[model samples]
Target: MTDLTGTSFEFPGEYYEIMRKDFRNLDAETEFLASLLPDAGTVLDLGCGTGSNLRALRERGHRGTGVDQSAAFLEYARAAGDEGISYVEARAEEYRTDERYDLVYSLFMTLNYLDRGRLPAVLRSVRELLNPGGQVVLEFGHLLNFVDSFQPNSVGHHRRDGVLITRLARQFINAHAANWRNEETLLVRTADGTVAMYDNFFDQAVLTGPEVRELLAAAGLTITAEYGGFRKEPAPFHGRGPLVIVATATPADTASDTAQQEENQA
Candidate 1:
């Protein structure tokens, strides 16, 4: 396992394996999201690590482009098989695309990487990068699930290629969301007394449902749906895994009343 930020180092070999192992459950979720878009023109994947999700979308017959702050991730994504995927190396806040996309997606709680203040800017950028009536699917772990825990939450032990990998993570909850700063250290113990170690930080931001709706609303978008898991199920007050939100960019005038109504009701 590499440090959470270690993915910033361009370690594609390690990342691809880690992500494949950890994100297996997101496949259904991604499919559900992709279904909401039109016969895609351009699909922008924010925080597209290893471009796994992007590749998945492409396999479904959509053209995909990825944006990430990690150069290592970008390098790895570029070399991914059956290439046509365009990858841009830039921070979520700093990167901008000249052309808007039919769909702009930030999956797996990538939005939580930015502080509350930065969210508006990021949302606006997504809005600007979206074609009119385009949809943006944002996914994240629900903070409400961990609101009671001041300690860490750890789970998962699966074997891969003769190596047994286990993950342990700690959770720190604050007003905004649960800061799950996971330290996933992979240790491979072998018969020859050989051991390998990789440390990575898998940090995620957990926001309340209202907080997410508000953030998108402020950015001139409307929330169409939210799910507790990848199955497109309703997100009750409590749930495991991530929150999947589907929003669409709205014009400035159309954004005002609808967003206010949602805020007041929430």
Candidate 2:
């Protein structure tokens, strides 16, 4: 159940191949994350665009299910699915699965695209979808990094499947607010000088580490490990770049049940 009218919008099926290709080299990060799940079981890959991480999970001996809103991506993922990989084409915020998972993951800054107010509900869903003691690994950009490294405008380029991706990023730095906007264009240069082009827009709300921690706490999940890089390096109080947050499931409404049990025992 996806709202057509939302601040966050994804190009239908348009970015699937590109995204899959772009993420193929993330094996190092995947291996790092896999190390955390020494005893992997059923794992939920929320916002699993193109099922890349699900592929990684299957390689690591875990049953994996992926959820995404992109019908096009799901189509590709289904064709790409292996023996134990399944995908659900639905919005991450609204997807419901009958089975509980031993681990849940929403990585690659996927949650940042969600509305701040809806984050608690998302985390609650993650917790509910997991078994007791299940863990969630969340990865996102470090807001402090943007504040510390403010480049008014910058450009970078990379190649994917012979397509040259040129990225131009702009920063808006103000007191209490720092905005980094990126404009990316992909150009595929054929041997004969022919070119194919694609464009996309991405915007997200800025939330600090403490704010994210509070939101997770409100969702009844306890933050067990917080790190700066995918390698699980310790995060400085105000360090930047990528951040990985590991949280374990905490049942919702524990206080009410505790009080009820106390009264019964009394």
Candidate 3:
């Protein structure tokens, strides 16, 4: 039996029996982040699937490392043969690094994968690994994107990098319990006529806006700004699409501490 369960069609990898489509609009996505991080020197990407964002950053001369839990994704990232960049196969909640970065980001609601109980620890770890005056960007748009957007069962497909991908998605919402369960079946086909299929289950934490703010504050991080989309525009009261958040450590001595650490390392 073919082990298709390990493959994801949304972020395709080389190991999948059938070619899959990678994430969409990667160039635009990375460019939007670049505008926000004009002077960023070092970057750490948490939950970086398939290394697309890291690859985009490296192309523009930013030193970057990607961390994710998928071996298949990491293998695909390493296969890109980019020596200047690195990939770590580890869970975002459990991973640690000695190096601090000028920017630490988790995109596409990656934080939702971690239990709410673990979010504070993740933030603390992010705080400890940030350089002075650095920033952390988190996009929790999934929370909003999924609202009123799911139909009973829907199928869609697109072609990218020569791979064709078809996905069937369904949602079961429990409003009383604040539970949103999504199940997706991906059918991938290579240009060479090979085919593969896999099922993915995503059950995420549905948090209120105020609850998120309190959680960030409790974690010693402050929300600097929130955007409605990639444009960096102010989020509307009842707007749709993804919501992005920019944050930083709340301590006053973080800059000095970072300077001291850099000097000691030097």
The lDDT per prediction is: 0.69, 0.69, 0.72
Model 1 misplacement above 4 A: 1-19, 148-156, 172-180, 188-194, 256-266
Candidate 3 segments exceeding 4 Å error: 1-23, 36-40, 142-144, 174-177, 253-266
lDDT of 3: 0.72
Per-residue CA lDDT of candidate 1, range 1-266, in tens? Answer: 32333122334354345646566665785678678767745688888877877777787777878888777677777777536578888767778768778988887667877665678888988898888788998887565654544356665665555555555545433433445565556555544556665565555565777887878877888888877767877777545556788888777778787767889999
| Residue 101 displacement (Å), model 3 | 0.5
TM-score of candidate 1 to 2 decimals:
0.80
Candidate 2 per-residue lDDT over residues 15-92, each given as its tens digit: 445545564446766786676665657888888877777777788888888987767677767777656988887778
Higher-TM-score candidate of 2 and 3: 3
Candidate 3, residues 25-83, lDDT tens digits: the string is 66667887676565537889998877878888887778778888877778788887556
TM-score of every candidate: 0.80, 0.78, 0.81
Under the 3 Å rule for N, CA and C atoms, how many clashes does model 3 have? Answer: 0
Worst 10 residues of 1 by lDDT: 1-10
